[model samples]
Target: METDKKDKLIIALIIGIVIVLSHNFVSSQKSDDLVFENISSSLDDKKQTKLINNNDNKEKNEKATIKKIHISGEINKPGVYEINDDYRLEDLVNDAGGLTENADLNKINLALKLEDQMRIIIPNVNDKDNNENNMTSQLISPINQNDNKKVDINTADKSELMTLPNIGEKRADAIVEYRQKNKFNKIEDIKNVSGIGDKYFDAMKDMIVVN
Candidate 1:
């Protein structure tokens, strides 16, 4: 009878040890699962943050590349505008509230790409004949008495600069070089050129403009 009791006691002790080990194993598994879930969640949050940052950076880069342009003449709104560098003349015109009913679209190149500090002039249909005559006369004489168009000193090329009175190739080249670094703020600013002075500027003051 004592032997039987001893065997029973031994069996009970063995069962109790097994139950404790099983409970410990299950708790360890649950802790491991929770740790895995937390690590996965942290990785997902990091990826989302990186994606958001990338989008913000892309937007900033696009804004940085924006170009400022000026549009005028025969338009609903004629003023300075900000646009993307890749935008064409048509896009700018559309943004400026489209052209007027009398706007001469045939004279403007809508496919021209926009540039920073660029100026665009939309012609009036009623002035077509006069504009053509002036263009023909410009080929013969740099300046025409009948033409009221003023040379834009800030945006004129070498040949256009030569149109000014007493401004030969050398002076034209100098004007172009000077304007490349220092844009003309006003008609009087042309006097800042190396060879241009009060006398030279006075001769072309009525014929030139800065925009």
Candidate 2:
């Protein structure tokens, strides 16, 4: 009877050891899984942070390419404007709500590139008493008496060009197409159009202005 009791005790001790070892192995596996999850979350957070920084840099570069300029004199809305750096003087005039009625479009170089903090001055056509420096610097053209009354060939559309003597739809379209490719530098430059000649110009000399 003593031998049987010893055998039973040994078997119970072996079973208890096996149970303890299984519990330890399961706990170790769970701890490893938790560590892997934490590492993956940290990597994801780092990637998100990097993406946000890259976006911020791109926005800053875009803003840097914008130019700030001040436009005044004869403009409808003269003050400050923020625009693209490559914008021209003509674009500036349009941005300032277009030129005033008396603003001279002939003298200034409209294709000039806008720079940061630059001041753009648009002179009036009626400033007849401009100084020698103003004439030399701004290159203001003389205001002809017929300018206000005559049809401006430079700005007139095809319909307005057709109002002239001997000008039909085909002739008017040719004038616009020619002007688009080669701008008229003077009132006499209208003769360069397909249908216009010396005789035609003479008849309409009093009726046209380059302005």
Candidate 3:
């Protein structure tokens, strides 16, 4: 009877150990499953964040590529407009409700590429004096009949300023704005304007004079 009790006790101890090991194995498997799930979730979140950032950057670049231009004179609707960088003068004219009946298309270069902060003036066929004042109109034909005569920096309009070599609309506008606040005492003083450095001044120094 004693031998039977010992065998039964041994069997019971073995059964208890097997049950504990089985429970431990199940807990460890559950822990591993949770770690894998967390890793997958983290990877998914990172991918989503990267995608969103790329989209935002794309949108910002598109906005940066847009150019702002101002159009006035002899147009149905003359105002500042936002246009694509690739837009031409004709495109901007159409955007401003097209040119009026009095607009002289011959004086304007419709194929000219538009630039940021550019001002466009459509000339009127009947207004000869006003057409002379129009920068765009003057650009098509030289206002100064004699090339030998130097341009007066102090009295020169935007179109006259643009007559200088390497001087575009932007630089011409800058020169006009600078002159409004301060007068050029001498021809060298033209360099004081922004974007008109030594090289640019050298190119047009002979063509400009201050009275």
Pick by lDDT: which candidate is best?
A: 3
lDDT tens digits, residues 58-87, model 3?
Answer: 999998887787676678997889998689
Which of the two, 1 or 3, has more lDDT?
3
TM-score to native of every candidate shown: 0.55, 0.50, 0.58
Q: How close to the true structure is residue 175 of candidate 3, measured as C-alpha lDDT?
A: 85
Pairs of residues at least 3 apart in sequence or in different chains that clash in candidate 1:
none
Worst 10 residues of 1 by lDDT: 133-142
Report the C-alpha lDDT of model 2 over 1-211, residue by residue, as the tens digit. Answer: 9999999999999999999999999999999999999999999999999999999999999887776776666779988899885788778888899988887666467777766765565657764433333332332112233445678898998777765654556667888888888888898998888756664465466678886
Over all chains combined, what TM-score does candidate 2 have? Answer: 0.50
Off by over 4 Å in 3: 1-11, 129-211
lDDT of 3 at 115: 74
lDDT per model vs. reference: 0.74, 0.71, 0.76
Whole-model lDDT, candidate 1?
Answer: 0.74
The RMSD of every model to the true structure, in order and in angstroms, is: 10.9, 14.4, 10.6
What local lDDT score does residue 73 receive in model 2, on the 0 to 100 scale?
Answer: 67
| Clash pairs for candidate 2 | none
Cα deviation of 83 in candidate 2 (Å)?
1.2
lDDT of 1 at 198: 61
